[model samples]
Target: PTTTQAGRAKPNILVTGTPGTGKTTTSSLLAEATQLRHINVGDLVKEKGLHDGWDEELQCHILNEDLVCDELEDMMEEGGNIVDYHGCDFFPERWFDCVVVLQTDNSILYDRLSSRGYTGSKLTNNIECEIFQVLLEEAKASYREDIVMALQSDSLDDISRNLSTLTGWVNNWILDRSS
Candidate 1:
C-alpha cells in the first residue's frame, strides 16, 4: 500500500519511547519492512560528532533529556525517514506523518535496563524515565492525538506485532495519500 503523504512526497515516522521499550529495535524492523531509511537520532548525534566529547551521563541526561526541535530539524530533511529515539517532543508535527510510542511493563523495563550494564545514577534516571512516562507524555503534548500510536512491548511477539502493524499502517498511509 501507499502512504497518505506519498503524493506530497515521503514523510517521516518517529518510533519513540523510553530506553528499554525497544524504540530502536521496533524502528529498525519498521524501516526494513517499509524500506525507509533508519535515522537513529542517538547514533546520528554520535556520528555527526555532536557528542564527541560527551560521556554517557551527559549524553542521556543533558543532551538527550533536553533536546529541542532545531536539533531534530537539522538532522532530518524532507523525505521518508524512520527516526528512532527516546524523545519526540522536539520535532515539528508537520515533519512527522506518524509516531509509534513503545511501552513495557516496569519489571521488564528494569530487567532490560539493568542488563544493559547501566549502574548507579545513570540507570536510576532511565528507570525513572520509563516509570514516569516521560516520552509518552511528551509525545502526547507535542502532537495531535491521532498522529501518535502507542504499542506495548511486553515480549518478542509484541515487538513483532507492533512492527508489523506499523508497517501496515505506513503502507495504508502511503496508499491513502496517493489515492
Candidate 2:
C-alpha cells in the first residue's frame, strides 16, 4: 500500500543539471518552499567520505559510486529526498517520482563557471555538457518520459518561475498523500 494508506509519505524529486546550472539554487528554494529534505549529493559524498580519493586531474573528489549509493539507499527508500547532483542517470529511476533537468545557455554557463574560477578542460567540458543538453537527454533516457521535465535556469526570473512551479507540484503531491 502507499505511504498515504498507512500514515506519512513524501515524494522524491531529483534536481540535476550541469555544474554551472542552477541546481543548487533551484533545489534549495524548492526545498525551503516544500519543507522536504534537500540532500546535496556532493556534500554527502564529502561528509561521508564516499569516494576513492581526490582526482588530481579533475580537481575534485573521485566518487565511489557504489558507496554513495549505499549511503543514500535509506533516503531513497524513505521517499522525501530532494537530491541535488550533477549526474542523474546513476540514480535508481524508481526512487524518484520526478526528475528535473535544469538547462542554461552555454555562454551564460561559461561566464558563471568562469566566475567560479573554472578553466581549461574542466570548464570547457562543463560548458560543452550544458551546450549539448547532456543532462536533459540523460534524464529523459533514464526515467519515464512523463516524469522528466526540462527547465531553463538562465536567469533569476527563470529560477523563480521554476521554484514556484515545483513548489505548487509539491503542495499538490503532499495534499494528495494526505487525502
- The Cα local distance difference test for each model comes to 0.76, 0.87
RMSD to truth, every model: 4.2, 2.3
What's the CA RMSD of model 2 in angstroms?
2.3
**In model 2, which regions exceed 4 Å deviation?**
1-8
What residue pairs are clashing in model 2?
none
For each candidate, give its TM-score against the true structure: 0.84, 0.93
Give the clash count for each candidate: 8, 0
Tens-digit per-residue lDDT, 67-132, candidate 1 = 434555533455678888787776766678787888889888888988998778877788788788
Q: Single out the weakest 10-residue window by summed lDDT for candidate 2.
A: 1-10
Give a tens-digit lDDT track for model 2, residues 1-179. 43331243888999999997988888888888888899999999999999999999989999888898889877777777799999987876678888999999888998999999999999998988987889988988999989888899999999889999898887887888786
